[model samples]
Target: MISTVLQAVGLFVATNIDDIIVISLFFARGAGQRHLTAKITAGQYFGFAGILAVAVLIALGAGAFLPVEAIPYFGLVPLVLGLRAAWSSWREYRDNDGDDDSDGDSATGKGSGNAVGVLGVAGVTFANGGDNIGVYVPVFVNISHTAIAAYCVVFLILVGALVYIARFVATRRSIAEILEQWESVLFPLVLITLGVVILVSGGAFGL
Candidate 1:
């Protein structure tokens, strides 16, 4: 049981890779206030929990209604999403702002906004969680429904905690800048890797 739980947790963490990246962008943009970070984090946690629970329950309770074969189709969703991100990243690199500071400065010269509204936060959380759901559905298809919910809850809490920590670091503007400078190369590399992972998981190589 313990090992199963650990495996579930690990998968949850892996599934949330895209969420972490999107939230990092929000932080870099300075979108949320100190308190707002907590709020948004909470929203993401609960939102993810809610979504996961629903998926599990629906799979269990409505198993007869769903096309079991559709389970693998979930993989296609993330593949498309990953391909989209890859395209976006390539475009961003091509349009690389010539005057944009490569040294952690905001390329658009825009201040991170303080008033990230509730709906906006929810929207961001949902958008960021999209890939997670895609990864999860396929994994949960054959698992016990309750186990799926448990994994979802645990995964969400971990993601929420990580987001909170990242936002806290975002408050320390100097730290954010310094880390970004040193890790700048890593950022694009991560984006590229995420794209590849999404495609691979979706069976794009076989397709």
Candidate 2:
């Protein structure tokens, strides 16, 4: 039981660490909007839930993570999202003369999050979840449903804890200041890099 629990915790962390950067950036962008924060939080939960659901389905079918070639397709989700974010930021800077960040760095990533709302973030989470499905299937296959339930509970509780930590990091004045200056450039780049890595690693386009 303890071993199973440990495996669950390890699996969740291994699969989810990449999401921390994306999720934290979202929280940072909307730090001032309590309402938006709630929505993003829920979006994270919904997105992860969707990933788990897929893993369950595939595991029950006794299959692997996905077809090898199809793995690269998941990369497109973040690629598109990153491109959308870059476009939005560029437009905001052009429209506002690049000096209108009194709201929360719209020229950075705030508007993208707002415009995409919960669904967009959820989409990113789901698409970025290829590794999650990959790691989850083996365990889900071997475990009983009751154990699966426990694993789910542990994974979810840790997710909430992760959110709390990342959100707290977002609220720090030092981090916030740096993010305002650099997130406009770095955030989209990170998403793009994530997508590219996923694509290349999955052997997309014969790369």
Q: Highest TM-score among the candidates is held by which one? A: 2
Write candidate 1's Cα lDDT for 69-112 as tens digits: 33333434334443444454445455555546543323432223
Kindly report which residue stretches of model 1 are placed more than 4 angstroms away from their true locations once superposed.
28-34, 61-114, 168-175, 178-207
Residue 193 accuracy (lDDT) in model 1 = 54
TM-score of each: 0.54, 0.84
Residue 88 lDDT in model 1? 48
Off by over 4 Å in 2: 62-69, 99-116
lDDT of 2 at 190: 74
RMSD values, in order shown: 6.8, 3.0
- Write one digit per residue (lDDT tens) for candidate 2, span 1-207: 898789888878877876777877877556556576677777888888877777777878834555534756788877887887787677777777847554554544456443536776787787788778787878888989988888888887887777777777776899878876777676678778878888888788888
Q: In candidate 1, how many Å is residue 117 off?
A: 2.4
Could you tell me how far off, in angstroms, the CA of residue 182 lies in candidate 2 after the best superposition?
A: 1.3
- Checking candidate 2 for backbone clashes, the offending pairs are none
Least accurate stretch of 10 residues (summed lDDT) in model 2?
107-116
